[model samples]
Target: MIAKGTPFVASYSGGKDSTLALWRAVRAGGKPLALLTMLDETGGRSRSHGILPAVLDAQAAALGLPRISGQASWGDYERVFVEQLGRARAMGAVAAVFGDIDLAAHRQWEEQVCAQASLAPVLPLWGEDRLALVREFVDAGFAARIVVIRRDLMADDYLGRVLDHALIERMLADGIDPCGEAGEFHTLVTGGPLFAKPLALADGDVRADGDYLSLDFGLAASI
Candidate 1:
């Protein structure tokens, strides 16, 4: 458990859930110690969403928080991820936050990783109704844009689109998980309650690769 004023880092993927998790931590009075991300070795992008590292840094700046990131090859994901958390722990972080909802495997992985670093794993939105949670996140004023989509599950049209109630409804109507828990989609948050200032972003073109669609975008904020 994290006592008040103890440092807590959020394992941010620039995704909606992780954004919400960070917001919850702030709401609970925890310091926004740092944003931890795993950058892909192919390029300095987030492994989960292919978002540029510079863009993520801009987002972090908008939130008035520092970032800790490291590059990792495809084969080194798990090891590198835990290593980043270990670094945060060594820096005096006592708790780590994750945005997982109800996936047992994910929860187990989070628990194991945090345990290895002697940091408590905090899941503020765990086990909640998916639809409700989606609604709640938007209602709470978080702004997120779809940054990646699994081509087989989602059309390229969704790339770079803002995640809103209408989008959620459309996803549900298409038999897709509104929250994209089944790998249907991934998001990048640009604005929210936790942010000291909203991120300024401009959407770019979308590219389709072998099973994934990547949305190109740029984030900028005054430092």
Candidate 2:
């Protein structure tokens, strides 16, 4: 566990895992230096969840934290990620938080990149029961919606569904990991104890790309 009040950077993806990770870090008394997200070379969409920059900014605003993003291609992803880690370090971040659960390859990569950047890699959700983590996230008042799903593993009906106990049970009944750890799904967190305000999402058409379906959501007009 990170020392209380230690400055940390969150490896944010504007998704459920990152949201839960950040929330736990704050609750554990870490000072959040920034939310760092990786973007595609065009800086149009997040590499993982296809979330737009504007929506990410809105999330940062609600969290009262700065959003730091870098554009990178597949070939230079690690280099760009290390650079972001260095930037966060320069901002007084002593460690960086990750949300990977039981993925040895992911953990190895994070540790390697953090070592290169001289930042300690912290994984709060590592090695825990997936179902328990999902339950904790929802039960703790974090509100999230399914924003991406594997077409081969999930149906269109799951797109944009709010994450809750019932939803997790349904996914489990379908023989999927409740936490979506195996690339079965991705999510967009809209509200929770960590946010100062809830995001009003303007739903967009669902689009399919190869084996994945993505939800195109934008910030709705605030009344």
Root-mean-square deviation of every model: 2.3, 1.3
lDDT of 2 by residue, 1-223 (tens): 6678989999999988888888888889999999999999999999888998889999999999999989999999999999999999999999999999899999999999999999999998899888999999999898999999998999889999999989998998899998888899999999998899999898987888999999899988731
Worst 10 residues of 2 by lDDT: 214-223
The candidate scoring highest on TM-score is 2
Clashing pairs in 2: none
User: Per-residue alpha-carbon lDDT of model 1 for 1-223, expressed as tens digits?
Assistant: 2356768989999889998888887777787678998888865678888888778988888888889987888788778888888888888888999999999999998999889888899998899999998899999999988988998998778888889999998888889898889988899888888677777887766778899888888753422
Q: After superposition, how far is residue 56 of candidate 1 from its true place, in Å?
A: 0.3
TM-score of each: 0.93, 0.98
lDDT of 1 at 36: 95
Model-by-model lDDT, in order?
A: 0.85, 0.92
Q: Report clash pairs, candidate 1.
A: none
